[model samples]
Target: MIKNEIKIKSEEGEVFDKKQIALAIRNSTFDDDLRCSLLDDGILDKCQGCNLRYICDGIDQVVDSYVDKTTEVVNNFDFE
Candidate 1:
């Protein structure tokens, strides 16, 4: 089982769930046509606008890795 976690803080101080952060990332309107859209859009800015930005930043690398791995798995499976 994978445990997704996120912690976001505001002026009042708050914690958020990481899965929610992932959803935000998945739903972001940033142009996906570019290969590095996420990075180009400014990961910090995009995340900062998100409710779970703080927590999401902590797992950015992990999330990217997972996405890459999942894409490879799906592609390989499709080829098979």
Candidate 2:
């Protein structure tokens, strides 16, 4: 049997390369510099012709929407 792990950085719609990911895991850290060196621009773009595009896109939509709404709420807080 095969296992897979998915890490979603919805704030930035870019996917990291294997090396960057490995380094992050090994160092126990992830930062914007590593994130900027993306292997691919978008997950949906990569999954365009894939059979599981629909499922992946659906999940992306839900996550993106949740993040957007949460950010909006947080931003609107009266911190005065």
Candidate 3:
């Protein structure tokens, strides 16, 4: 994994712990498409079963919004 640091804020404007978020992302079973959506900056609108949903605030939307980049990063295992 690239192991770069990233910060994500919750809908309540609370910041998620970086290591916690990274662990969640690393262990997530969500597919590339789903993972992408979870990483987007847009409103998620839907995330029922995601463990990180509370802090991610619809990362699925973010991921979906950046389909090309997400796919590339995912394919490269940059976020592994």
Candidate 4:
């Protein structure tokens, strides 16, 4: 870990840093729309199904929110 690092844990307990996640998103060749197995169930689901889901939680809105939050944190984070 560093002053600015993207460390993330998958629903399956797997870990992914920023670069790994970014690459997975950028290099994905799948055409199916991401979906969360636990969408609207009031609890997060494990990273099941597609590989995208493994790293992205398989929900578009959730992924977007995660990205937005990450950006916000990066922009405002005060590293000491």
**Which has the greatest TM-score?**
2
What clash count goes with each model? 1, 0, 9, 0
Q: Which regions of candidate 3 deviate over 4 angstroms?
A: 1-16, 26-57, 65-67, 73-80
TM-score of 4: 0.23
**Candidate 3 lDDT:** 0.52
Tens-digit lDDT track of model 4 for 1-80: 44333565678774658675555454342443444556557465554554566445443555565566655433565689
- The list of candidate 4 runs beyond 4 A from truth reads 1-16, 29-33, 40-80
Given candidate 2, what's the lDDT at residue 35?
Answer: 27
Tell me the tens digit of each residue's lDDT in model 3 across 11-77.
8775657675545554453552224455365545556775776656655444445454455543543
- If the candidates were sorted by their TM-score against the true structure, best first, what order would they fall in? 2, 1, 3, 4
What lDDT is reached at residue 40 by model 4?
50
Inter-residue clash pairs, candidate 2: none
TM-score for candidate 3: 0.24
For residue 1, model 4's alpha carbon misses the true position, in angstroms, by 19
Q: What is the C-alpha lDDT of each candidate?
A: 0.55, 0.47, 0.52, 0.52
Looking at model 1, residue 60 earns an lDDT score of 67
Question: Which whole-number lDDT from 0 to 100 does residue 37 have in model 4?
Answer: 59
The per-prediction CA RMSD against the true structure, in angstroms, equals: 10.1, 12.8, 12.8, 14.1
Clashing pairs in 3: 36-63, 37-59, 37-60, 37-63, 37-64, 38-59, 38-60, 40-62, 40-63
Q: Estimate each model's TM-score.
A: 0.28, 0.32, 0.24, 0.23
Q: Per-residue lDDT of 1-80 in model 2, one digit per residue for the tens?
A: 53243454556785545654444443332232222112265544454477765765665565455446555443555677
Candidate no. 2 TM-score: 0.32
